[model samples]
Target: MHMIENGNVAAALGVRRCRVNVIAAYPITPQTPLTERLSEYVEAGEMKAEYIPVESEHSALAVCIAASSAGSRVFTATSANGLLYMHEQVQWASGARLPIVMCVVNRAVGAPWNVWNDQQDSISQRDTGWIQIYCSDHQQIIDTVIKAYWIAEKVSIPIMVCYDGYILSHTYMPFDLPDQDKVDAFLPPFKPDYALNPDEPASLNTVTLPDVRVDVRGELAHGYMEIRYLLQEELRKTLAVAAEAEKRFGDIFGREGDPYLESYRTSDADYIAVGLGSLTYQLRVSVDALRKEGIKVGILGVRFYRPFPDEAVASALKGKKAVIVFEKALSYGYEGALASDLKSALYEHLAGTGALPAVQNYILGIGGREIHTDHLTQALRAAIQGSISKEPVWIGLKL
Candidate 1:
């Protein structure tokens, strides 16, 4: 079925197709419409799910946390400060190894209180043990929402299907609304590895000692450190599981692939531009312009941000002359997080093989600042001609 809809509604329709059992959310700018549509679906008896409209974003995710622990397919959405409000549970959900899928409509975290688009909100939460998948457009938003469920369930980790607020959330675009039958065929119902069942009363996520301990049943249980170690190991394995999920999704829906990195003309390019979310797709304009001028440049979208696609990034970027990275979020004093991580991956992957590419970092569009394609073209052009900066460049700054 072909339907033209905003990214929010696209996500709502995808969630409906997914047969999500529990939908809990609180309204925030750019993200409010996504949950509002879900609430309508639940109230109108169109979708058979519990839409719990909580008072605050914290409680919204807490509802998901509780519902997911009880073996329900749960979902929630938040942006900027709201996501920060649920920071504790953000860590808790993944630490508990619950397959809860969330849509993080990316927005700038407020200091002076602006309610516009940026990737900083989700970017800040990257260390919180959740698998973050950034989307480029409405199609990826809907498709990734469906695939997120499959991947999360396989790895038993929470996933943030992140996209820039307003940029993708409110923009109207045509995406194939996947058939309900195919979605049913692709995603199995949530059968948790363990849940809070009264019939089989068991202690879950209780206080742990420093080291390994024996439980009441004389079973060797993981301690605090051991549990953390297991989460780390499972997150690392998520890359492979996510790849398999993408393959199954492509086979069934035919709109999803390359779970880690989405490359645009990078095959025979010397300089590659890397970024996340819709900006990566927009950067292709610059790539095309540069190509016409006989400058070999390309765009690499880092899809799976957390678990950091070390090998995929290293493989895509190693042989390039310079990897120009543009980001919407900055890591305070340091460079853009994506740029820093890419450089680190290159260091490890190109240790003995070849010289590392000059990873030039540029921070732009923070707090809803306007990003122009020509700006990208000029930045890459400078890098290609060996005119670069060791420090991160802040684009469109007013001194």
Candidate 2:
């Protein structure tokens, strides 16, 4: 079915179609409408799930953690300060290996109190052990939520589906809605490897000594270091799981997206613009206009942030003359997180090739500031023509 909907509604519908068992959330801007729609679905009997209204984001994820521990499929949404408030629980959920999926409406964290589109909030939590997938539009938002559950369940890790607040979250678009039967066929019912069971009660997340210990059954049990290592190993599995999920989703829906990075016109281009989220869509427009004007420009959209697609990124950007990173979030004194990661990936890949592209980072749209195509075009032109310095360029800043 084809319908006109915004990112929030698209996400809610995706969760509903997945037949989520529990949804626990606290209301926050941009993200609120998503959960609000889920609540309405539960109320109207359209979705058979428990909608738990919590007082804070911490409590909201706590409810999801508890439900997921009991072998229930769960979901929630948060933004900005609300996400920060759940920081501790976010780590807990991933540490516990709960397959909980969440929608994060990307917003600027407040020191000055702004409620607009910014990627800093989510980018700040990049090391929280969750698989972060950024969406460029309503279609990707809907599709990613469904794939997130599949990937999370497969790897027994939490997934964060992020989209720019107000930009993708509130903006309306036309997208194809996948049939429930087809989705059911593509994704199997989640069967967790471990869960809280009364009949088979066992200690979970118990404190372990420094060394490995023997269990009652004379089996070796993992120590703290071992457990941490296992978590890292499982996270690595997400790379393959994400790729498989995208392939299957594409085979079923016919709208395939690259699991790690989406390359556009980069095959024969000399300069490439790199970024994530809805801003990438705008950057694509800039790329096209520049290409028409005889500038060999392209775009590389970073889709998966965690378990970064190092090899794919290196391959796509290997021969490019320059790669400009346009980001909404920055790492303060250094470049943006994505830019830093890209540089590292490029360096590692080009170690043997002995060739490298001039990488530049342009921090833009911070605190919900508007970034127009003209700004991107000029920056791309400057980078391509070697007019801009290697230092981070702060776009739209008042001199």
Candidate 3:
């Protein structure tokens, strides 16, 4: 069915279609409406699920952890400080290898008390051992949420289906909602290898020692470090799993998916603009405008952030002259994290032959500050013309 609705509702419809058994919902700006729609579905008896209204984002995720541990398909949503509040459980959920999916409506964290759009919140949680897939629009929001569940269950790792707050969450756009029967066929019932049950009465995730130990059955068990290694290995392998899942999704839904990143006109371009979420799509205008003046520029929108697609990135940007990265967040004392990561990938894979591209970082749109296409175009032009700097470029600064 074709429909025009906000991103939150699109996400909610995706969750409902997947038949999530439990939703740990707490209201937070931008993310609040997603849960609000879930509540409406549960209240109207249109959706069959347990909608647990919690007092805090921490408790909301805690409920999801418990429900997911017991082998229920679970979901939760939050923004900015709300996500920071769940930091402890966030690591625990990933470490425990629970297949829980969450929607993080990207927002700026505050010391000055701002509630606006930025990638800082989720990007800061990069080391928390979760698969973070960023969406660029409402259609991608709905489609990615559906695939995240399958990928999480396949890898025994948690996943975050993230999109920008207000930009996509509050805005309405037309998208094709997949048929319920098709979604059901694509996502089967999740059956965990282990689930909490009265009959089983097994204790999971207990305190562990640094060294390997023998269990009650006299078999050697993994130590703390060894367990962490397995988690890292599975996340790396999830790249292939995600690709296969998306392939199956395309076969059924008729929309081919970009497994790691989406490239727009980078085939013969010498300069490529890279970014995440909806802002990257907005930069498409800059690419076109610059092309009119004989500047061959393209856009590279990163989709899967974690388990960073270094190989695919290196492949696309191998012969480029300059790679300009526009980010909504930074590394505190240094340039944008995405820019740094991109340079590392290019250097590690292609530096020996001297084919490395000049990577530039530009930080903008912090705390929902307006980002103009002309500002983006000017930045690209400056970087392409060798008028760049060592420090990260801060676009739209009046001071």
Candidate 4:
């Protein structure tokens, strides 16, 4: 049954129809709509799932850990402080290697208690052993929510589907709803390899000493590295598995999926702007206007953040005059995280091939501030004119 709704409702219905066995949720701003929708689904018998309305975000994630430990397909959603509240369990979910999929609306954590757009909370857990996927639009959010299950289960890790607080989360957009049969075919039932079965009862998330540890820590660290490696490797794979999944999605539902990154008029440009999430969509509009004015500027919308598509990024940016990286979060005392990673990607290539372009980092759009077209237009013009200096630059601010 297809319906017109916001991204949050669409996501809730997608997971509900996927037949999730356990849902642990505590409502928070921007993400409450999803859980609210899931509640209605359960109440109306549209979904057959156990919806646990928790007292707090911490308890929500705790419930997820318990359900997942019992080998149920568990899911949750939160934003900002809610994610921060579940901080401990975030690591627990990954350390235990539970394929729990979460939707974290990118909101700013605050001393002033602001519930608006920002990337800090989710990005703060980058090292928590979860595969993070960013969505540029509502369609990507719905599609990635399904893809996240396959990716997480295949690699046996958690996945966080992040979208800007207001941009995609609150904005209403028309998106394709894949047929249930196609989704069922594409995403195999999430049968975990390890679980707490009564026939074969086992301890989970146990503490251990450094030397006397049961290799859980060692295996966890290794599993994290391997999962990340495979996640990147899967992006490079050109076989039927990934492609067939995307093709089946397209054939049944008519939604297209790109392998890694999306390019916009970069074929003959000397400069490129790299960004992720909804900002990239706005940047595309800015690029088009600049191009019309005879400005040779283009954009590369980064879809995958954690794996860091170094080779793909290098190939697209190679021979370009300069590359400008726009990031929503700051690493604190360092440049933007994406900018640093982009430089590192180029550095690896530079070491092997001895060729790379001048790159600069621009930090912008944190704490729910506005990012206008002129901001990008001026930044790109400065980058093209060689007026921008310093390794780390802050964009659209008095500084």
Candidate 5:
């Protein structure tokens, strides 16, 4: 069962020189191999780092938070329900502004017991204030990890490099591994804007009332609004920060990826299929097939999720006839989250500029259901052929 080109192993080795000084994780299906491989590399002396095997997912994140607070670059991996269990600490990591990088193998949350790919577990936490980057393939899985540190440390926020469980995580493909010297030159030691220093000795995570609090210079300020504004401004700047990181990564690696969104064949197409994660790969293949049949269909693959790339999406879908948002998770009572967010992003463009393209959302994959080429192709063809509604459309339903 040993595969020479497994994506998880390739990604682990690809970012091996990031110098992860600490790792704290608990084993979970589909994501277990990722941490396991890191442990192997550490034991084999490939990476000089401290590996902390924790008892539960909650403690896994707790350990990372402690290490990062002390100013050490940390790493971890988890999937499905494990990520759900770390939900509380997930917010704490971002609120404390520790730039830790973790690999999220996107999987379905279970009650009936399932181990499969779905974005629901992570997608539901879209408001966690961490930079969420979704990957389409194994190559991206590795490349994004290194870029994540650059982006996170630059903006002082955490990042989750998410890949579809089993799809990109377990698949095998040949990929390039960066040299250690180049990586060292690219990423330096962790220098936080602030850290938990014993000598400095400041209050960490102190609660605030509506009244007052002391600032660093002993000035009075509204702690709640001040911290909230700081978090918001820093989050808004993550888009540009990630873009700059991608530019630097490209300069060294000779491959450029837009941190927000990537458009394909949109300049001349009439319809665009907006997709994320592994589903974009299938959507691209189907779009090619649809093109061979003389249909003009393009693809817009969403890479960044948290800081939604409104401008990039608006630019790509400006002159299109219609846009079909292929969503992997539903927003429960509000239709597809990506679809609703995209609609909001395009409203200004439609009002300011010329007529914007028609937008329709389709919930395709949920609860670990399979999404194939025929399902995507047929739905796209239907939308292009007739008048599709602006509301969210559910694809591949059997009822």
Candidate 6:
């Protein structure tokens, strides 16, 4: 089925098709519409699930945590301060290893109180133990929601599906909605390995002593270090699981892109522009325009930020003269988060090759500031000509 819809509606429809058992949400800008749609689905008998309306974002995620521990497939959405408010619970859910899926409508965190598209809210929480998947458009939004549940349940790690607020969240686009039966076939019901059962009771997230101890069966029980180590290991496993999910989803739905890093015309290009989310779409247009003007430019879109796709990114950007990173969020005194990660990935993997590309970071669209192809084109041109300074460039800045 094909229909014209915004990203919020697309996400709701995807969750409904997944047969989610519980939805606990607190309404926040941009993200509110998604929860609203889900509520309508539940009320109209279109979806057989409980729509939990919580008073605050903290409670919303807390409800999801409780539901998920009880063997239910749970979901929720939030943006900006709402996400910040749920920071503690976010860590709790991942620490408990609940496969709870969340939609973070990327919005600018407040100081001057702006409510528009910015990736700061989600990027700030990158250290949390969740699989972060950034979507470029409405189609990816729906598809990623279904894929997230599959990946999360497979690895027992929570997943965060992020997209630009207002830019992708409210913008309308025509996307093909996969048939419910096909989605059902692609993604089976989530069966957790362990749950809160009265008959088969087990202690969860119990306090651990600093050192490991022997259990009743003479097996060593995990200490704090061991538990954290296992969490890191599980996060590493998500790289492979994400790839498999993308492959299987494509086989069933016929829509496919690189689940890690998507490269366009990067094979032989001298210059490349790299970024994540809806900004990648604008960068692609700029790449085309630059190519027509005889500039050897391409694009590398970072789809999966958590796993970082280090090896793949290094390979794609090996021979390029310069790789310019466009980002909407900055890491305060340091470079943009995505740019810093890319630099580290290249340095760690390509140090032996001695042919690392010159990398640059340009912060744009922060606090809902507008971005256009011309702005990106100018930045790419400067990067290619070696005119951009070593420090990060701020696009659309009045000063």
Off by over 4 Å in 3: none
lDDT of 2 by residue, 1-399 (tens): 999999999999999889999999999997989999999999999999999989899999999999999999999999999999999999999989999999999999989899988899999999989999999989898899999999999888999999999999998999989999989988788888877899999887888999999998999998888878888888887888888998999898888878998788987899989999888889888899998998888899999999788888999988788999999998878889999999999999996685688898899998888898899888888888886565799999988
The residue-level lDDT of candidate 1 at 17 comes to 92
The lDDT leader among the candidates is 3
Candidate lDDT values, in order:
0.91, 0.91, 0.93, 0.79, 0.84, 0.91
For model 4, residues 194-241, the per-residue Cα lDDT tens digits are 778899867775544343323634543333445445544553442224
- lDDT of candidate 3 over 1-399, digit per residue (tens): 999999999999999999999999789898989999999999999888999989998899899999998989999999999999999999999999999999999999988778889999999998999999999999999999999999999999999999999999999999999999999999999999999999988788899998999998899999999999999999999999989998999999999957999999898899999999999899999999999998999999999999899999998899889999999999999989899889888988998877788888999999888999899999999999976679998998878
CA deviation > 4 Å runs, candidate 4: 1-3, 212-254, 352-354
Model 4 RMSD in angstroms: 3.7
lDDT of candidate 6 over 23-137, digit per residue (tens):
9999999899999999999999999999998999999999999999999999999999999999999999999899999999999998879898899999999999888999998
Candidate 1: global Cα-lDDT?
A: 0.91
How far does residue 78 in candidate 3 sit from its true spot (Å)?
Answer: 0.4
- List the lowest-lDDT window of 10 residues for candidate 3: 351-360
For model 1, how does the per-residue alpha-carbon lDDT over 1-399 read when each residue is reduced to its tens digit? Answer: 999999999989989999998998989998999999999999999999998878998898889999999999999998999999999989999888899899999999989798999999999998999999999989999999999999899889999999999999999999899999999999988888888989999877899988899888899989999889999999999999988998898899776668899999999999999999999988988899889988889889999998899998998888788989999998998889898899889998997787678888899998998988888788888888987788899888888
Q: Which residue pairs collide, candidate 2?
A: none
Better of 5 and 6 by TM-score: 6
Q: Residue 95 of candidate 6: its Cα lDDT?
A: 91
Superior candidate under lDDT, 1 versus 3: 3
In the range 137-212, model 5's lDDT, one tens digit per residue, is: 7778878988888888888899988898888888887677777777877788789877788889877778877667
